[model samples]
Target: MGYVKLEIRCPKNVAIVTSADPDPVWTLDDLLSELNSLELQHGARISVSSPPKKSKMKEMANGSNKPFVMRITDDDVYESESEDESTDQRLITGTRFAFPDDYFSESDEFDDEMHEKSTPSRLMQKKSIEEGALFELESDHQLMVKEQLRSKLSSLELSQKIESENSSFAMRRLEKQAEARQELDRRLDKQYQRKIAEILDNHLSILQRNHEQRSQIEERRIRDDATLEEAKRKEKALIDEKLRQEKSKAEAEVRLNAIKQAEAQKAAQEAEIRAAKEAAEKQAARITETAVFDASKKDLTEPKGVENTRTSGNIKQGDFVTKQLGIRVIASKAALEAESNRLAIYDEVAGRINVIDQKVIDKHGRQMYKYIKQIGGTVENVRAKAHVLVQLIKDPMLPLSISLLVFANKVVSLCENPSGSFDKSAFACGWVIVLIASQVPDVMDLVLAEFHRSCIYTVPKHLQASDAASQTKDYWKMLGYREEDGKIESTNEFLNRVESCMKLYAALIQTEIVGVKNPYGLNYGWAWLAMFLNALPANRTTAVALEAFLKMAGFSLLRKYKSQFMKVLNVISRRFLPSLKQRGEAVHDIVMKLEQYLDDKIYLREPEGRQLQASSLSKFFE
Candidate 1:
């Protein structure tokens, strides 16, 4: 029923640019240049956005705080390899980064070597072979030494040699045995050292001397305790004194708080009394003003069938008559005349719109334009204008509800129409209407008062009652309409009209709505308006507006509505998106569908029928 907000966590692949300038113009080349410049510095793996915008750009341009939309295209747009080089390319935001097979060829050997060496299994195999070779050499050397020692044992020699050999052999054996014994002794010594360390670490006797010293210190401390007891008592007294001071401080704070609260209460009471007196006085004044206005109105109404009358003094007869009825109001006539012309054109155009009046349209258009200017709209104005001439139509006094509707509708129509003038007056008028209209929801409760004071008709009682009934109804049957969930059904024809009106509304509101305006006008102006119309059902005219918006959006309202379609798809996606593979497949499917659709509409062979078919297809997705 109000505005819709979407929180999109743009992926790394998409670049966004948001603009606060309201209107901006830049070509595709411009956008590409900016992105290319950015890529040269920030890398291609970024999404640069202009400020958060309500819509997309008609043309690309550098925007102020505006976010520009970008996406990596490496995933798409390629077919086969080239003869000159292997055509492998990565596109970031439409700028191609080519990666040809030839480009990688020079590094192939290096890459292979690096790859092989990096493999854990391969590295381990090489290490094992080296260790095996070293072990084999050592084993061979040990075998040779054993053979030599055997030879030495078998050698025949003189008595001295044999004796010497036996003695040397025995000595060698003795040395070996001694070395073995020495090793055993060393191990035993290490064990003994470990045992000693364990005893030292675990035994309480290790600390006996230190403990005795500590005990002596404790005894001395006990002896000294008596002397310090007096000081301790004094310290306790000081602590008590500090505690007393803190207690007094806390009490004082509590008293201060109480006094402050009392003062605040007294001030509040006095303010309330003053406010009450002022309110009473204001009420009295309002009552007096109402009485005077009523008396004057009554005097005028006493006359039979009075269509319009000029007022004398402070009394004006007609509801449409402003203070100027008595005395000419001072304002710019030229600006007023321009508005008059615009309104005239609006009336003519809306005259044909069966159930709606041009005045309400105008009022709404003006209001929307005002809001646009306030938020920020382009200095340049749109070229289109809504103009219609009502032939064989009677000039009738429109009720306030109908009149307001006409006024609002006309305002919307003018903004939608490109062939219109722009001026400070147009902007100002729109601003005032929107400012006032914003207060309407709040004022709905005070409709009776507004009616009495302003002498405008209230919302039709039957319409209000019917609205209430619809709110409570589980289902209200209307043939030829489809029901989707809790929404009311309406005929396709009716929906189409609503969509059309929505387009008109969007065109008017886009400039004013935050984030939706495109200086070059590429963004869908009517998105918000379409959303608004889809949700609204207060009036048939509103339904017509919604249908208009749908048509403009190139969407069919009869079969699967765009919003509903998106909702259903989104629900399905949520179920499958938890799995990466499934999500990728889904994305692939969507991409394929879009590609096929584009090809069919743009590249099909049909000649004469192409335009019509293409147009129809465009409308389907509009």
Candidate 2:
């Protein structure tokens, strides 16, 4: 077939750079201009054309190529070309070197003395004239033809000898192959027998072990039952003894009460006489002491002997004061101190106090009128004050609901007021308020209304100082992401957050493992880890790690946390399924490893052992 010419029009200015540059500066227009200049300076004689365009460009681009054409150059650019004299004979004529047309002319005479060929084909007839001119005698030409035939026969015999040798070698190879196959069959049969024997032994051992365990469990169960019965009997006996004690105590209490009644009357008379005598003595002492203390206080003399007395007097006063208060005062003081110690405990449970600036709200009223109108309520109508706010939340007004606006001024004021580390009342009140506010679908409409004219508070440097985004991206880097400047550069902060969330999810799953039992718990841990790994984006390193983890924990183990794993899988599979055939094998390989591990542990005593038998036969076919 005549090779079809390929062509492509070069842009007037385009120029392909010979070498790549880090800071190469070139524009589309510049490239077009360069190409046009190059073409004008050096025509077809200098510039080469690109390869041809075909209907299968898409397929070819993937990694396919057509036959090379001489007209096209090495560079991936195009130019048109014309057909040449040399055509592929197999494509055009189905044969090589056809007879020339001039042989059919009658101008050539057939001579008796001319060397003759016996062939009657069209090609022979055309070659007759040339042959007659070369060999004039028929006998001489015949002898030359006979010699050529002998030479060909000799070559044919040599070829037959090589063929015979090849046939014998092939037969020998076939026989050897048959023998090798027989040997393999014999070995396989022996292995199969061994496997069967091992399986039987494992079964027997497992049965024996199970029988022993069952008996031990039965004995323990019986012992537990007997102990439980004994405890119950003892409990009943204790109850009877308590009942008899209560009866005896009741009789004794009645006798003691009757005896106490007579003593009460005698005591009351004695207490009245004592109180009167004490009052007279206290009044006389108070008057005398008040006069003496007043007269002594007037004196400022620091007497040397009185210094020791003063010290002793101070010590005596401390002792007396402590004695008077004793345990009750200490207990009360301790209770108060404990309350202070626990102050921080409550703060954590509470939220910060968000005080609203009514003045700001009033000033921004007109600016926020649109929002208020949207909510079908006026800000002025909403209730204020802590307790009133809580109550209003319990029963919000129709159409208006509840809108709590924390103005920039209010936020600043609250930050300044360090009285409450966190305000419990404010947090509780806020939730209650929001509950009421939810009655209005357009709660934001009314809420933003209060802050319409308020300035957007610049986030405090202290609050915004956390490297949350960077840290999150770094965590993903560990999981595997394209790193930039020694850190993962995710397209958005949101993806980093997702990566961090996956890490948390993995941790939570492992935490949940602490509460699990064998089979069930192990499965749960494995499943959660699988889910976390699965949720990770399709990165080669991450995928490999996931496969390894899964293999250590089987897919069947996911049944341990079926509901949770399935929910995660449902979301992940949508993204993964398109490439599942490639990934599934990886997952399966990991699962097999885990399954084998579990089996080994569960049936250690079995003859076959816990390990899965390697599928050698399947591997051979593969």
Candidate 3:
């Protein structure tokens, strides 16, 4: 960070001569030393001054409190011993600063020849040598240069006749230019006068034509007006005669309409009476049928102590008990939460996240799960549909059984579709689940079930299933593996899918949407981390999920828990890493990632692309 660029100038010319080529990056004294060597090489007095005011950053860059002024005069070079210089020789080359030997190097053969020459001869031929630039000009040298310049300036004089001829040529050229301009202006003026006269003539003729047109139009309009008036008078007389006839016809038609209306009203009244009689008869029949049905139902229902003693031969055993139907007084999760005080705050943390099961649904009937899925929430509205999903899942209007079943299905669906961008689907699901868990702690049980069912380590548990207990494919499937007709997913891809799930889960654990201080946030994240490191054994699956979880939520956990959280990290370093290492190349990449995450302390910064529930909620609200 402590790097600087140098600007060098020559006082004689009062312009920047060269600049730092590589850019100086060292203490101020070292930069000043480089300047000294540069000055000695050029035999110029170099006075260095910094900016008028030093910046705070600049003050921090160096330890030196001394004034920012360092000068290396020509006298300083003569006084300093040669042994003080460093071994490396850097030179200012071209218009740039601080080039190496190759840049400023002269022809090798020429340098050798110069070395062979006597010092006096070298000084005599110094004007041609490149090294002449290295020597500052003394008083004698300045005088010699001025005299040479003056001698070169002295040359032959021009003849008086030649000078006079030149002056005459200049005067004649000026006269010619003036005569041409005057002729061009006269031509332009003549053209302008002709155009003006032409325009005026055209205007006068157009006005005369327009006046004649107006007169003709006026005469025609007057004749048309006289004709129109005569036609209007004739049409008016005819209209009066026709109106008289139409008035007589209308009086007769009105009498006929009135007679027809009276007859129609009589017919409508007769039809209404008939319809009323039919409706009354139908109503009487319906009442009679209902009376008969109620009498039959009373006879059947009120049979005194009558029971079906004879058993049906085709009926299966325990059919009567199994198929019995009655209203179920099923207790809901909200009722249980109230009883258990699952959401009650104790100490500093709230116990909002819980494990949901089929207890409530079992009371209602397991088929409610199927029913809930069928009539489940709609995903029609694509805008923040996840928030709506949370509401639907926890809707009390929906049967508890149906909500739990639908929620479980939704959670399990994410396991397969974790193949896509996590933020859109999988991570968004995590946000929904967190909110539901916070407000409705009963849902946490369902979330845990689905997560643990897919990846056990998400529950912070590792299982080593026996080969005899299940086939290889079945075991992998338990860990959320995908299978086609026969082929199973590759381990790396499986880890990728599982890692996305882990990211979502981990993110949800620590995600705090500002308004709703997540009860299951950093506090839960810390506990999850500590519990996972303490309980889980190291393996490729564990390694992937652990590393992914840390990457997702570690920043928030570290910030929240601080030193206590770091102790858990130390445990990971001391305990978890060795087990991963013993797995050889199977988990080599994961091990490396874990090691890097710890070494670099990547948890110091928030994971990218992970939207906390608070941010997501704000977006939804917007």
Each candidate's root-mean-square deviation in Å?
Answer: 55.5, 46.7, 44.8
lDDT of 1 by residue, 1-622 (tens): 1221212123466575231111123332333344445456655422332221222221223453233233325443232112112422211112222333432454646545544443232212333343344334334334333333333334433556989989999999999999999999999999999999899886767598789999999998987996699789799768766865685575456545645655575466446545644432221111110121211121122111211111222322211111211222211222222223333333333444566656755554454444333422222221111111110011133322333334443343333323222322233323323333443322111221222111101110101111222322221221112346965544343343333333333232222323322231213232232222222122233223322332333232213244553442332223212221222332353334333433343212221110112123444587
Count residue pairs with overlapping backbones in model 2: 14
**Model 1 stretches astray by more than 4 angstroms:** 1-403, 409-490, 512-622
Report how far off residue 420 is in candidate 3 (Å).
6.1
In terms of lDDT, the poorest run of 10 residues in model 1 is 455-464
Candidate of highest TM-score: 3
CA lDDT of every candidate: 0.34, 0.33, 0.50
Candidate 2 residues lying further than 4 Å off, grouped into runs, are: 1-266, 269-622
lDDT of 1: 0.34
Which candidate leads the pack in lDDT?
Answer: 3
Give the per-residue lDDT digits (tens) of candidate 3, residues 374-441: 32122222224445555565444444434654566456555555544454444445555665565655
* Alpha carbon lDDT at 364, candidate 3: 39
